[model samples]
Target: MNKISKRPRTTLEQKIMILNHHHKSQNSQAETVNHFKTKYSISTSSFSEWLKDEQNLRSLYNNSNEFLRNSKRKLNFKYDKINKEMDKIVQSALQENQVINEPMLRQHWCKLVSIYGVQDPKRISSFSHGWLTQFKKRNGISKNKKPIELVENDYDLFDSN
Candidate 1:
């Protein structure tokens, strides 16, 4: 008996790449699938599903940043509008040399979510540090950027004392 290696979950970038090749290729589905299997390790079932959702997948890729290619799951757009508002606020805060941290972002997100109301009802009132990380990445906001944090010791953690 041979041990079968589990296939890795494909990111949006990989899916778009594979789909583009598959569509542009002169080869048949089986042939294209074979090529993907050898190169990307994507299974036929996943290919079939991706093909079915081609329109959505392509749209998502178009909306996403190629350089910041998303993780296994696509970006959940429930907070998209909120994200724009937050982007403006972050930019202004950065201009004014405000400290950007997880708690501050969470509190701001809460206020925005309440004021704007949520697009997705299932969306929670609070966001996690992971969500904040993704939000920063998507907006090209760097944590290491000195302008965003004026004081070395000025942070939510240190302020609590």
Candidate 2:
């Protein structure tokens, strides 16, 4: 009797990664299948099985998009945290009548990443002038002024005026 070999099981994450790679590449479907088969040691029959599972393919697509969205969210959160910290530092300096410039801001960011042990210091340090400008615009923060603050009894002050 001939022995039948069992195919290796793959995780959803691995499947998603493969599908994303295939989606992003300029290769045709057949080329992608062949590439994945050779690279991952998967058989063409197994690839066919994967293709036949509509639900699995849909899940893979959704999961891939979700992965990208989550990555973007994490990066945005990092940027927001950096922006808030920078605002605090700049506000403190302004109180002391010191002007904070872009170079100073970049230095403060480097110091913050070093002190706080950010996961990817390079990401934090890779901010270009255009990126910094967009970040400031998005956060509505101005280097020349303190961030706007809402205070209690502001309506009373307006009434008095």
Candidate 3:
């Protein structure tokens, strides 16, 4: 049987230090993972998790700063104008008996993806979901619908016109 080493949980700060040290030493992520596993007596999985946590924290910190900047730039919202526009759209959709379905959204999204020449379905799904959620939130619309499965054929054989 192999040895089961007890790896201690290292702090986020320590993980950052290890990452910076490896970066300064011109080491790749794989090399750093291996090096940390041996030098710090930590498991490879733990090191990988630490790296992911560090990257996520960095992204969140950057996004927070961006949001702050965006908030400062919004001087004229024109709430009434936005409400009128949304009301018009809602009335039009209701008159046409048009309901927004996942397949329709997926089809529309696939057209845009094809126009942009993007082949990654995950990227398309994430972008579509983000836009839909943001639009719903802005219009004060309820988004309690079930999650939709985006199939490979949804993009491959879809034509939105």
lDDT of 1 by residue, 6-116 (tens): 667778888888888887886766787888675566777878888999998887678656544656776566567888787777777767766776666666777788888
Q: What are the candidates' C-alpha RMSDs?
A: 5.9, 16.4, 15.3
lDDT for 104 (candidate 2): 60
Clashes of 3: 0
C-alpha lDDT (0 to 100) for residue 79 of candidate 2? 60
Q: Write the per-residue lDDT of candidate 3 for residues 39-127, one digit (tens) a residue.
A: 45556676566567767644533543333223312223323343344345544544564554445445555545555566565745534
Candidate order, lDDT descending:
1, 2, 3
Q: What is the Cα-based TM-score of model 2?
A: 0.34
Q: Give the candidate number with the greatest lDDT.
A: 1
Number of colliding residue pairs in each model: 0, 0, 0
lDDT of 1 at 114: 83
Candidate 2 displacement at residue 13 in angstroms: 41
User: Candidate 2 residues 1-161, lDDT tens each?
Assistant: 99966544444455656666666896665777777664455665665565576475555346443333223122344466676676677557656655445556566777677666777745557556676675455434454454333222233221101
lDDT score of residue 112 within candidate 1 = 87
Cα lDDT, all candidates: 0.69, 0.55, 0.49
Steric clash pairs (candidate 1): none
| lDDT of model 2 at position 24 | 85
